[model samples]
Target: MTELTGTSTGQPPTVDLGPYADALTHNPHPVYARLLEKSPIHRATQPDGTETWLILGHPEAKEALSNPSALSSDPANATPQWRARYLGDPNARELPQGKSMINADSPDHARLRKPVQRAFTPRRINALRGTVEEHADQLLQGLPSDAAFDVIDDFVAPLTLGMICTILAIPDLDRDRVRGWADRIGFPTSAEDVTAARHELIPYTDQLIADQRIHPGQGLLSELIEATDDGQMTPTELRATIFLLLNAGHETVISLLASTVFCLLSHPDQFAALRDSPTLADQAIDEALRFQPPAISAPPRFAREDCTIGSTTIPGDGSLVTVVLSSANRDPREFTHPHSFDITRPPGELLSFSHGVHFCLGWSLARLEAGIALPALLNRFPDLAPAAELSALKWRSGPIVRRLEHVPCKSGARSSAAPPHNN
Candidate 1:
């Protein structure tokens, strides 16, 4: 175990988070709070033994995310040792060609994101309201009204997966296989397993794009293919973009839905508040995002040059850097009663969707889905509550995203007009 040093004041010592990895995976709030009391910028050692910096303060995270000149998103900007240990050596591993917008900076990020932005416009996302509602209604209708069921498997996962698949125009027959590959790639048992999954997915993505090329459909993939023809994006870029969309598009929303439900069920007052006033759905979503963001940290950014987030100066020699989104969202300096889960809490500087150039592209769509689903679920089952103990609920272990494995929920007779039972 790494030595724990430093206090809430003065220059804090560099702490290794390796020991708290499990606890952080299960319940990160307490650990994050303890760290925040020490320093906004803390030096940390990665599992691979590489030194890194974690930015935990709201203002500091925003600054680090906003300044791409000092911190580069491209893996190429990483030091050779850090890259080799984490991502493997360039020569040894043949990485997929082209860069997804998430990994690109400046002009490239802008260019890649612009074409997709049109597809996610207010009008476009709003048009999916019917689809979102329809899916939520259909899924809820299928659930046993008075029995324990996995909210994730029976409702949330399918709702989100369907929306993303519909957007990508993936064939109904291939959706399950695609989702399986995506889950494997996103949450692998080991580096080797993730590598195998990526290898399998890359060829499938190439073929998917090729099919879109020959037989254009109404999907975004076809539009992206057209964009490729206009020289806005390349063949490899199209494949990478599709892969990113398929995985990130659904996975984050799943996390959002699960986390939101967990938060609400754990706090019956808030859940009842949302149940009583459906209009607070949006506010509830915002509060849930702030209280427990889907992604714990943004993807690691490399230091292009020496950068100082607070008093801590990150070295210029391609040091790895991560902006802790969950930490920043809960920063006392940013919000009143940062630890409290209040749906009525006004929206503020929440870093859930992140900031600056690398902001999530499908944020509108995500909000649209959650805004509809949350209210619908509560209305359909007014007496909904978690079947299992909230404290003992398990979360998936990973570095970037925080996800619940399952949300075993029990509900009463379906009745939209019924008042929630006080327990």
Candidate 2:
């Protein structure tokens, strides 16, 4: 067993991330590196007061994530205090939006995932290539030829929003409402805010499902509705599925597109390299996902049985455990020059989309968007650059997701550096 770091009070070693705001916002690799060196596992208390065991090492995280028999995603397996603190309600058994594949264990997860999986087949996703390109082109055309604009709000978000909406067949008018709910839930400052945003989103999702039943559309939702009718899924599961798609569907892609642009711009040499060789766009996207993942950690998994990660044994009786993807992806043992943003590096083990059965379903879609959006923007503008110093740009302060609030950039002749816009 590794010698645990100790505190003066003689309690177990604990890491509170709240104190490291600046490091987390600007760059969190150094802090994570120090923690990984000490031990792969550490005890920590979340801002909401939920105690959790964090898996930091690359191998340790893989072991924990792959062992479904030992680690469960159901909150029912979580400690009472963890459940109470995490949900902000002592009586709450599930998240405000209810159970979905991302938080389900075993048979339930498999059943829920099957139908959605069938709907997102390669053919289905690949067919959307035309739509993705069209959206990117339309957004790029609107950019001022020689001025600063937010890559996030003006381009990435709308393109992602359009893609997800088109896939789910969400109406044009309702698209903004869905985006608004996703924004609030994705970057929530408190458990209460998440709860409120989810509560608002649920009814909206339910209504969409209801509408689909009456007038079947050509989108994935209509297919999922059929699955429900065939006894493949329950009504509650249908609602939960749509809710998950709407929320996670676009948000992850937004993070991917925006973060890739920001990372390349920050490393001018790499940006130039990518421009010189357009085929490297795919490699660049993968590197961006590794260097600055959209998500900070996977949903907390509870110990269903006594499980040993590295030298630490997590109790069998419902203990909260979180796999820190950001840390694991940067573990020095896992990659060469783990902290540097090198787009040409060969892809290997990456936890950015997580591992095991819960790996992100929309990963391919996100890559496709980036493949189209990045090259399209660059090819058109050919001289797009950051308008503000990378440090001057801001990231939303949140626990689960690390997304830029906005990415200000200059196009054409406006590539000169300037102060950050207040937006």
Candidate 3:
């Protein structure tokens, strides 16, 4: 383990993360590099004045994520003061939203993750390739020939949203509303906006769950509903699990698609490589995930007991710790030329979707979507390039997820010539 020194009090030095939050949003690599260089772990203050332990090194992050006993996923295990300080309203009585597998531990996590895990298996995702490809082509076909299109609005958002909705069997009429709720929740907005999105989404999800229970269909949601019927989960757990899948499923893909295009377009050589050898699509997607992960950090984990992460000790009193996945993916100790965006780089582990028990449930689906969507888009528009300069792009402002506000690209007339290979 890498030793990380702290203050005289044994607590890591306090750094205000607020000042760098905007910079972190726009392009976090530099800020992350600085933090990692100083120390892989730091006690940082969030914009809202909440204190948290931020882990930046690849090894330390893996340690924190894989150790569930010391670092509990249950927010309910956190101290009342910690909850009140960070989450607000500690006394608020509500159903266990935190009981979802993403936020659960041990027996609860296993029970919640088991029922629907089969739906996201490699076999199931492979079966959905046709549907994913069909949707990708449909979205690509709609692009205008004469002008620049916002990839976020025109392509990634709709493609990912539509795919998840189809998989979950969400009604078409309700998708727009669901998208609105997802947008408000996923991006950085006012606290009121977040609360409002949750308010709208919870009741909507409840109704969806109720409907699934009554009239089971052919999707993962229906499968989970059956699990609920069989005493595998509670109504609240069902609702929360569905909500997690929907929110995580679409949003992460949105970021992946946008970031993949942005990265590829910026590196024309790699883009050409992928375009030339379409077989490299899988590697390209992995590189994209490593280079610019959608989720910059994992959800907060609470320390269940006095635990030592590296050489630094975290008190057991429900202290919060967040693993910076973005940083870990770029750690030089783990990857060769970590800053370079090389699609052909040897495959390796990535903290982007996290590791251990809480590893992303929808990873196969995410990979499948990117594998299909990227090559199709490039194949259709060989001359596709960024409509605006990188400096002009606006990134979403949030600590957890990193994404551009829009990726405007000018798809010039389709190239009749064969795809060019890197010279």
Give the winner by lDDT: 2
* Model 3 score (lDDT): 0.81
TM-scores for every candidate against the unseen true structure: 0.93, 0.93, 0.92
Per-residue lDDT tens digits for candidate 1, residues 6-44, read 656554566877777676778778777788887788877
90, model 1: CA deviation in Å? 4.6
Tell me the tens digit of each residue's lDDT in model 2 across 317-423.
Answer: 78889898989988888998888889999787999999999988888888888889989989887888787777677787465678888888887543434322221
lDDT of 2: 0.83
Q: How high is the lDDT of residue 8 in model 1? A: 69
Each prediction's whole-model lDDT (CA): 0.82, 0.83, 0.81
- Full-model lDDT, candidate 1: 0.82
- lDDT string for model 3 (1-423, tens) is 123334697565687767766666777788778888888888887657777898999999999998999998888777777666435568632323446888888998999999979898888899999998888899989997679899889988888999999988899898889888878878747766676677778888988887877888888898888888899999788888888877888888989988888887777778788878888888888998999999989987888899998988889988888899989999998998988889999988899989999988888888888888888888778789777775567878454677878988887633233322210
- Name the candidate, 2 or 3, with the larger TM-score value: 2
**Which segments of candidate 2 are over 4 A away from where they belong?**
1-12, 397-399, 412-423
Deviation from native of the Cα of residue 96 in model 2, angstroms: 2.7
Worst 10 residues of 3 by lDDT: 414-423
